[model samples]
Target: MARAFCSSDDEVRRVQSALDEAQAGRARTLAAFAVTVGSDGAVAGLLGLNEREVRVARRTVGKDDAHRVAEALWERSRLDRQPAPQDGTPEPDSTAYPNEAPAQPGPTPHVAGQAGEPESSPAVDAVLTGAWHTGADLTTLAAELGLDPDFLAARAQQLAAEGRLTPTPAPDHTGRHRRMVEGPPPPADETTYLHWHQPAPQSPHHQHVSWEQQPPVTWGTPVTAPQHAWDGYLSHGQYSGTTS
Candidate 1:
């Protein structure tokens, strides 16, 4: 006998209704041979399977066929509905689903060489130099050099926070204590000045004698470019000058 299983309009509800009718041994909307095809290609409805048998198999029997029927009914119901607005306001070059907004790119950091303002500064140079040459922490180095630790830390932290300095972690309490990590060296207060070596002048090996008893002698070729020359001189193992 021909019977309407379930229509797309009310596929699931209709199938369930039929199942109920069959279980109760009442009139069934779905026939024994009628079947429903879901949007996903699952099959619902029954053919040759009696009402009571189908009910038992689907409800009490818990057969896979019952599950297939439910899935089929759902899928077919969704597919049979009117086509959704495939192209809202006419499709653009790109196809986007309805209710979806265009994607936006994230903001990028302002690089030094780019059109943005220059990021280089004397403070930044000092922090970087301290970190490289001495392997010192930014905050500790700045403090040791009598600089504002906050300002120095900011510059160094910028590089670190940006993941550029992934090799080095940020300065913490531990890093601050590392200021003295260089270890003890010769004290700067030592006043002893002893001459180590002197290069002969390219000239006639000029020698000058003072008439004054034990005339004071200048040291180290009279150091012309004296940038931190005093510190450099002090660092020398032996310092030499007229011991007046």
Candidate 2:
């Protein structure tokens, strides 16, 4: 019995803007899902997104049931790619008949529920385990695996740090060693810092989250929730939050 209505041109414009934003977000999310299943660099390049954005989208998707939906979609695609008798189509001839044409082997397509090594990336991967061939050119290996050498090296190091990978005769350590560590700029001289209105430092919880996390901020702190809330709102946290 009710009809939707728009009040004014401004309201219509706002609705249209919101819809546009929603559509862009949907595209980004789908691109991110594609990234999760062997399409990382391709989807990232197509959508003009960097690895962090792709990873963030993937993590966001994992926070809900959407990841399962993506996995289902992958399975469906796998099924469609396989030879099957669907829609009354004839099943592929797998038997070696005496007179039939010999099966020509081509690059194998990726298949789920199978143990076959993928044609795209070699299955016997040892880069992450720090067991790739000694004196092997990892940059070339990364290219072959469609990965960045830096990332491969970093993951191996991380795994080693976690004691999951053994550092056998160590690979060459390069990138992280070269990165510069810069501390914050000098604190604008104490007088200038005092003159400027600085936001009170908040516990890490308050700025980014709301609802239960807001009242929820102090759940881990020894201080009471009221005290935490009071501290968070009273410009007591770090001097970075926007002021009213």
Best by lDDT: 2
Instruction: Give a tens-digit lDDT track for model 2, residues 61-159.
Output: 553545566666778889989976567766657574556877679998856322532322234234434333233445556667775554455444444
| lDDT (Cα, 0-100) at 178 in candidate 1 | 50
Writing each residue's lDDT as its tens digit, candidate 1 over 103-192 gives 778898666443533455766665554454334443455557665544444455555445443332333333222534534434434343
Span of ten consecutive residues with least summed lDDT in model 1:
26-35
TM-score of each: 0.17, 0.21
- Clash numbers, per candidate: 7, 10
What lDDT would candidate 2 get against the real structure? Answer: 0.50
Q: Which candidate is the best by TM-score?
A: 2
Q: Which stretches of candidate 2 lie over 4 Å from their true place?
A: 1-6, 9-21, 24-28, 31-35, 38-42, 63-66, 72-244
Candidate 1 regions with alpha-carbon error over 4 angstroms: 1-123, 129-134, 137-140, 168-244
